[model samples]
Target: MMRQWGLAFSFLISAFSGLASVPPDAAAQDRPAVSQCQAIARTLPDVVYASFSASDVLPAQARAEAVRITYLGHSTFNIETAGGVSIVTDYNGWYRPAATPTVATMNKAHSTHYTLNPEPGIAHVLHGWGDGGGPARHGLVVGDAYVRNVTTDIRSGGGVMEPDGNSIFIFEIAGLCIGHLGHLHHELDEGHYAEIGRLDVLMVPVDGGLTMGAESMSRVVTRLRSSLILPMHRRGPPITAFLSMFDDSFDRSYATGPSVTVSLRSLPRKPLIHILQGV
Candidate 1:
């Protein structure tokens, strides 16, 4: 039954993509600004999972149209889009890909989760917190991707709740909604979920202590239920402990390398916890 549903969904998405591929002059005037992923979420209550094996490498041509996600260790991920856009999530100074990204996002929960000075040649730098008293605001479109943010609170040095201190960045690219939960310190409310929309791939902080506890973070994972869950900010026992919470419901895959290429049509059929190489 589930298999049949997945096939149908894939077919429908393929047809939708065909229509979307029409020249911009033909559909630009009629197309809505809302992302394709969010539109699907609004119409379909449940996001049917698609099929892709993380271990299978694709040919160069197919990979050119896909998004490459590299786990650069310790809460940083370099996300490269097929259209030549590269974004670094939780970009503290130390961990980074060889080439500077087109955009870099940072959070203020800790020093490691952010950096004061990023390397040269980066196109944009988005801070999760605002320089003034207000919350950070980011709605940027570069190449084939649209980047946005939903503000969330964080715990300050005194352990008091600081409102709108963190941002959960969402990257909409290639008909997929990829999100990074940056130094998340609490469970999400309905409003936060609404703003975030649906996430096909989620880069989550699974440290279990500094961000949030295993149990609480597990609840967040259960609620989002992203097709692919990439655990970042990993510490030994917490990674194992967090996976245990979803052992029955989610499939676990340990990728041979630190990077994985994914496309809209290549999402996993079952919810998967994909652990990449390196901490």
Candidate 2:
């Protein structure tokens, strides 16, 4: 799987580099002011959507439109866009993959979710909490992907609410919108929904208590309405409990391997829970 992804990623890097460069000023002028979710929701097709569960059999030429998602255990996922942008979510000092990511998104809820000293090779290290301000704000576009964050409160050791202590990082790439709910502590509100818009894929922590109760997280999942769900940050017992919360409205599948390639064309007609095997 890694070998196949590497080939595709390298090809995309070369292909994207050869494209005519857009001046920063001109690119900024073309960017929309609305959130990615709202933008995708407006353009959703009326026909029934479909999903093709692919392991590592994709052709190298399809790399241009494919977004490969590899679970790196816990809440960390390596997202490689067709434009060759690489991102690691909830990046801890450990669970480092062989490939050095261009962007690393971290949260402060626990030591395992962040690192103060990241590798020098990483170009962008985004923290979810503020350095001293209210909440951290990240809006960056690299190659073919745009990354941004939405703040959420977390529970302190004493169980007190730590405002804006966590983040929900959203990545818009390859014409698909993906979201990572990092260390979510409480249920979402209207403001969150408005900011989140429509997600084609969601990476959520289903550890029952670490992030939230299974029932609570399930409700949040229902509200988000993502076409595909990736489970993370859970052991066997927790994963089983979390799975039981979903009803007939959703379907569940276990991946034979750690990575699954996706594209806008492969999103499911109904919501799905994909249990990737890397963990």
Candidate 3:
């Protein structure tokens, strides 16, 4: 489905190219300090460096001042909250996509949902509980940002007993609490729902084909009652279905901007549903 096999060789070329023409091991001192968070300018203001290497985990970035959200197509997202918490969700984005991340979230339940190679410099890498039920439970705090993992129910093909590690992330940053649902295969039960309380921004998968259908996603957004809803993973019918739903529920407006960067100081004003035109 995605040309990931080529990315490794390409990564080596890109990594070493940035390092000088030598064996990468020789340039160990020039590895970009992947263990720490270094703020780099992207189209968004405060994106940190992280890698989604598929086998390794990143350290963590502390002391972030702003949060910027960039849609890397499909379900992949790079989020930097004003408090300096950087998060990447279901990182199966493009190979050489313009932006890398500081922290990446990978869910192994579906092939299209997760990718190999996070951005070149991100630190922490988190995964949801997968079908095999491995390495899904994780918790980390970066500066004032607190990130925790919560596993929810999965019923593939509209709630079948697939036992996937669908993840719900809680980000406490900038006096705002936002959550991203990574390839969710089913609706959240009571206990699962209870853990994801008071979400200020909700990143959801509108595409019903890979994850849950539109009705289930609608129920999820309603259940969370988030202040802002950012739609992802819905490149096909899910986008149409999600927009139709949003148009009916809230004053849906297409955003002239790429992302809706919000801080707590600007929140508690009524909820606004923004859809990006160029995502």
Candidate 4:
């Protein structure tokens, strides 16, 4: 898939390099709620309707706790733990130098995965299959955090069409397991759910019908029964569709600032979905 970069993001790729890629597959799953969200994908426009400024973004040096998490745009995010463990997801192009994480993950299915090696430094870089050749690997560890990636096929273009492969990532840090769903083109079944296991926080792709769609994302959330939901990979019309459908009662609200900090001890006992401001 072609990846369109936000203006500020255009600089990092250098004078060459086109974009990243992901593996495709055959996928199809029915989600009643997602059907409702399809309306949003079809009707809404991109989020550029409202302009965002750097002042609105949190300062990079601002402390993020081992318990602190901040959504960078789309599937890209920075998670810093109190004990000095930091991880980022989809190190896609939509982030700045400051937002770059020490340990970042790359999904090979879409434009928003992986990255050119950072000038500062990167502790670990894990590749989600389709981009690499081999049996495919899942599970990683950086400091006190353990990470894993799972793959499933997403059928596109109508009846059982398969394109690129997709992956769902789970990062376990300080006992809390957080999952990030990337360019997922379909819903998960029982087996997929079992593989996903219990999630404390879920980073979802909410492009409505455009990218796996909202209904599908919701279904995963329901089964995973995660405590937090960080909506991503959404802009324009789809965001409206996703937000409209996410009207259930949970300890839900936007985060404190652009990023919300947390630690193992502060973990929630009950499920709560917090929409943190995306970078």
Candidate 5:
């Protein structure tokens, strides 16, 4: 009880002191001029995404204009930018792709989403949890991407809850704000939406019961209203249930291969649900 109050007090102080770090010019324009509340009030929603053909995988010539997202099974995705930076989401010890990543973001929902020991050669390993300290804080630039996180609580066990146990990692690359909801456990609050700002593409968990219920997850996805939605962290039954909630208005398709590259220009006018195989 005391710890919870202390954490609340800390948040209040941080809010009052204006302890926000300086964001990029794009972020500054979209986000509120304060910490915690990063999203700005917007009147219109814009669609932002791009894609490449299956044969275009890892072209020798670096395409600095588009972002490539390769599904490496489960909740892990290899996000490659035009400048040769690579990032792996929900990284565990298993399921490493051919190329090592420049950065790895992890969450503590389960062993499948995180690893105690990561590769030595990896440059950055961002943990979702605060290592029992506080919420994990990450705001760094690597090559062509800017990475940050917004923390949320998780169900520990026996109905107990642990605050700041998970993080929603946002990758700003190629003029797109790509968000990965790592082991999400609840519906987002107003503060979370504000901090998340506007997401162009979103990777969400649809396990129905593990991370959150399909209905609730669907509501959260609709609330974000990103251009593209990539489903992960579940098998067929849950994925099917999650998909049933969205009607024909959403563009639904499965990737031909294990990867799909997207940029701002290739985004659909309406929302899309992309199911990548091998997961």
Candidate 6:
């Protein structure tokens, strides 16, 4: 059922543009129910800066309503939804929360980005790359969250372009669209953007060299214009360089801790670069 739509979307990508596209099935709302993030197009204003504490513990009322995002270092993040569904993004063997994640998504760009052997308790393990020679397709509702992916190419060992080698996983939960850019190696095109749709929070790779250059990556950020940008796969100077590109137009914020609880009501009025403590 879900796989059919995913496969159809994959075929659409191959048949038309080399880039991924949102399938008719998804556009027709035949799959995992549509979310507010996809339904509403938010136009946000420009710059402001603020420092705040991103508490690990959710407030009483928010505990059953908001989405908790915790940066576990590198590209791995533990995203916990109100419905008790936990998802780990770029799930390598290390850098995870104490409890096992209900859903684990992995990319195979490097060993740090994924692991072949995930823990036994995980209910859903989605690979960014496909089994044989096809795009990794995912569109499903797990608990209260809707998860899907848009495929992208990756740089292989010999510098060849491996089609559909990576996936940008989008999670619709707590009325927010959260996207994790997995080991992304190239700049996205119009079709890719169209497939991705709206994102409230975007988890991106800021390692200027390993993924893509700051200039190119920043272009994608500007186009997406997500309210909150969470930078991952960061090293020393690249993080500074990446933020500098948006300094004039985007607000910058430093979180006291690794965790932040976000709901539709909590999104920043202006676009912000939220730097978590560990990453």
Model 6 sits at a Cα RMSD from the real structure of: 10.0
When summed lDDT is taken over every stretch of 10 residues in candidate 2, the lowest stretch is: 45-54
Clashes of 5: 5
What would the TM-score be for candidate 5 when compared with the true structure? 0.78
lDDT score for residue 203 of model 3: 84
lDDT of 2 at 120: 86
Residues 44-94 of candidate 1 have per-residue lDDT tens digits of: 444433432222222334333689999997989999998788999989989
All candidates' lDDT scores? Answer: 0.79, 0.77, 0.58, 0.56, 0.75, 0.77
lDDT of 3 by residue, 9-79 (tens): 34534532453354334433333311111111111122221121211211122112346776666666667
**Model 4 TM:** 0.67
User: Candidate 3 regions off by >4 Å?
Assistant: 1-66, 83-85, 93-100, 116-120, 130-135, 155-160, 238-240, 246-249
* Ranking of all predicted structures according to lDDT, beginning with the best and ending with the worst: 1, 2, 6, 5, 3, 4
Tens digits of per-residue lDDT for model 4, 1-279: 023333222322221121112111111112111111111112232311111112212222211234667777777888876557678788865674374466777775556666665435676777665655443455544444556766766554454645335677777554456778877777776555555555667888776665665677776666666667777777555345665665554456666676866544455655566676651
Superposed model 6: Cα runs more than 4 Å off: 1-32, 35-64, 236-238
Best by lDDT: 1
Q: Name the runs in model 4 displaced over 4 angstroms.
A: 1-65, 97-100, 116-120, 130-135, 155-164, 238-240, 246-249
For each of the candidates, the C-alpha root-mean-square deviation to the true structure, in angstroms, is: 5.6, 8.9, 14.9, 17.4, 10.4, 10.0
TM-score of each: 0.81, 0.81, 0.67, 0.67, 0.78, 0.80
Residue 138, candidate 3: C-alpha displacement in angstroms: 1.8
Which lDDT tens digits does candidate 5 get at residues 1-279? 455535544553454334223444444445533322132222111322132121222122322368989888889999998888899999996978798889999998789999989998889999999975878888866665778998999999885889999999999776567899998888988767767867878999878878888889988888787888999888546567899988787888887898888876677678899988864
What total of clashing residue pairs does each candidate reach?
A: 1, 0, 21, 24, 5, 0
- Off-target runs (Cα >4 Å) in candidate 1 are 1-33, 40-64, 236-238
Please report how far candidate 6 places residue 149 from its true position, in Å: 0.2
lDDT of 2 by residue, 144-188 (tens): 677889899989988999899999999977557799999999998
